[model samples]
Target: MPAQALGLPLLPPSKAKGKDFRRGVNMAITGGTAMNFSFYKSLGIENLVWNHGSLDTQIQWFKELLPSICGREQSCKGYVRKSLFMFGAYGGNDYNVQLLERGLTPEQAMNYTPKIVGAIANGVVKLIALGAVHVVVPGIFPTGCLPIFLPLFGDGDADLDDAGCLKAYNLLPPDQVPQLDAPEAGGSPPAEAPQLDEAHVRGLLRPRVPDGPGAPQVWV
Candidate 1:
């Protein structure tokens, strides 16, 4: 469904001033990563990172805007509590940077999944600390089904699954997949805040796929 359909219109970019954020704000940037460029620098691949707008950077932007969004600490807490926070489907670009730019195989890229997930979890914890009561942190989509990966990673007929996706890359590692659902920062979410995952997102996007050859497939 469209953001407006859910009553959450597309958030304006951080730089968009004089606009109302009574709905929300968007800090995401194209080519952003879950892990910062410094992390990539540690791996000796920082040169491949074209955009420095990592999750941390976006969070900082939110922090800078928080005071203006809600004045007093107590009022800000209430504003944050009532608002829904949508964290991410984050790790995609983190892996993309490595797979497409640094030339790593899917399996090799999987090695960073844990760290990437940790970073997202940490971001959620930060949101909760800032008084978020309803935060939805979504998982990455099935990578193999993505159009970009299909052409670049497919090697032979055997690599394609019955559904026509690259079989090996269709799913995340079982252990890594559940880590996103585990307690945030080692504790359960606030009692008022229900834990949510990607399933909720899939349900929203699934119904919007039109039936036709030209219809765009919704990947969640």
Candidate 2:
């Protein structure tokens, strides 16, 4: 639960001396592709469509919910001006589809990354436009280090971290880690790995930043 409470009122768990206080209604939707469609479509899949939730559905949801929270008659009338918006942790669904459904190599799967990133970046911008002040977009996990990846591309000598994660597969560049340089007396290096980081995320999302002196500060 890597959470942040921004300008939100925190209340006691139980009533004290007949004084009752409670927190605001917090809305959280699933972000991945398995049960979510937004991530699935972004990964370049068009034929088989399935989604419990999508970005469009969420935006509409916020539109309806914001007015009630802000004490207004209608939706999104600047009521969400100071509300916290948690957007992502997306792109995993895209990666999953590429690797599992398409049966593509890591390198091949990553080629479709820009499309997914752009889609996520655009979603963040949409939230900003809707008056969401604090937005938090989570990063994806290291797929190569995931349990499913090892068996898919196992070479018997798969280099791993202390937790058995692939050493060759990480967020850092291959050149920076010596494990990717050469094979040791133990396991082999990873053939490929997804690069997930703040810099990379910000770089892709940068282009969508509003061209103004007072543009909102979005952290992904």
> Highest TM-score, which number?
1
- Give lDDT: candidate 2, residue 215: 63
Separately for all candidates shown, the number of backbone clashes (residues 3 or more apart, or on different chains) is: 0, 2
TM-score to native of every candidate shown: 0.75, 0.62
Worst 10 residues of 1 by lDDT: 188-197
Checking candidate 1 for backbone clashes, the offending pairs are none
Q: For this target, which candidate reaches the highest lDDT against the unseen true structure?
A: 1
Assess candidate 1 and give its TM-score to the true structure: 0.75
List runs of model 1 lying over 4 Å from the truth.
48-50, 173-220
Instruction: Residues 1-220, candidate 2: write the lDDT tens digits.
Output: 2233465454322213443322334333443341245455565656453354555555566566554445554344355555555565666766667767777766666565555555566567677777666677877777767787787666755466677766544432111212121222012233442244334445544555554654666776
lDDT of 1 by residue, 140-177 (tens): 77778889988888988899989899987765522233
